[model samples]
Target: MRLTVLGCAGSFPGPEAACSAYLIEADGFRLLVDFGSGSLSALQRYAGLHAVDAILLTHLHCDHMLDACTYVVVRRYAPDGPYPPLPVYAPAGAPDRIATAYNISGESVDDVYTFYGLQPGSFPIGPLQVTVDRVNHPVETYGVRVEHGDRVLTYSSDTAPCEALLRLAQDAHVFLCEASYLDGVDNPPDLHLTGREAGEAATKAGVGRLLLTHLVTAWGSEASTFEAAASSFDGPVEIVRAGARYEV
Candidate 1:
């Protein structure tokens, strides 16, 4: 399995990074998690806009889902000719909201991408296995555990520290978590996790690697935050950067 960080900023985008987007590939298929700003372009650079096999959305926040609307249009009406509909697995009610947010006719967009609503549990998508767990966020959100063969990767998308997330990521080879706030930078209740909080979750989950993402750019250097998170776990800890790829 291969895990790639497409975008990893929080609240909003950084000067060099986009918002939340991840590319996980296993068994020769690609799955996209969260299509934030510049993600479509990033995917294009990596493997063309049409190379994606499916999309799994965790929430409907602008930075997490907005680019999906744009992607639908491009795939549906691009001058290069239309591509076949890609299956999209997302939280309940996501399709309707995406259609409305982009001012797109449901039929027009629906013809280009088949949308599937996911609940908090396991589901299958072709050669991969997926498990969704509810997470703590302002809106309904999910953390996903994906497995293919002997490899597994879990992602906590914009969530606070929660038992559900810990259980979902248990024993994962890679745990991609969001640390949206610094310990003392105007903490937001029920919406985000601090760097240390993410570390604790990873340690409790017994993951092999802890990859910290969704950083708020205003926090300046994340060196201190990464160091703090590292204190909790003996595994590899990485502060995600765009264009970096990890093979597991």
Candidate 2:
């Protein structure tokens, strides 16, 4: 599996990065993990607008899903005409929420996207095996574990410390985790994880590599986040950068 970090900024777009988005490709199929704010423009640098086969949304937060509305416009009124409706897997009420965000009729958004409600279970997307689990978050959020052949890649969409995340990341080749809070700081409960907590989870899960993402630039420097995560995790740890690609 090939993983590409289209954007990695947390909560909002920073000067140097966008919000949360990733592209995964394997066996000639392309799957997008999230379509966050300013991600569409960045995605164009890697793949065409119509190249994506499917999209999986972790949750309906604006930072993670707002660009999906812009994508609807791109697909609906392209030069050639409307493309086939793309399949989108997301939480319940995603279609309605996106429609409201787009400020258009539901049919308009539905015409461009065929929405599938996500549940806590395993499913197949093309050649990839996907497992979904509920995580610790204020909203109905999910973390995804994807497997292709013998390689496993787990994405912790956005979550605080949770058993479900640890289980999903078990023996993963790559753990794409969110480190939204700094070490030794007070953060709200059930919202986000500190870098140290992320490292602890990576260590406990025995993942091959840990890629820290969803960092808010306002909180601290990327180097500090990497240092905090590396302090706990014994294995390889790095911060995610937009436009960077990794093969697993």
- Which 10-residue window in model 1 sums to the lowest lDDT? 104-113
Clash totals for all candidate models: 0, 0
Task: Itemize residue pairs with steric clashes in candidate 1.
Answer: none
C-alpha TM-scores of all predictions? 0.94, 0.97
**lDDT for residue 37 in candidate 1, whole number 0-100:** 73
Q: Which window of ten consecutive residues has the lowest lDDT sum in model 2? A: 101-110
Question: Model 2 scores what on Cα lDDT?
Answer: 0.92
Write one digit per residue (lDDT tens) for candidate 1, span 1-248. Answer: 78888888886778878888888888778889899876777777766777688999999988898889888778878898688888999888887888887785554477777989878889887678999988999888999999988888999998888889999989999999887777757786889888789899998999999999998878645987797789878899999898899986
Between which residue pairs do clashes occur in model 2? none
| Stretches of model 2 off by over 4 angstroms after superposition | 104-107
Per-model C-alpha lDDT, please?
Answer: 0.85, 0.92
Model 2 TM-score (2 dp): 0.97
The top-ranked prediction according to TM-score is: 2
Candidate 1 wrong stretches, greater than 4 Å: 104-108
Error of 1 at 125 (Å): 1.5
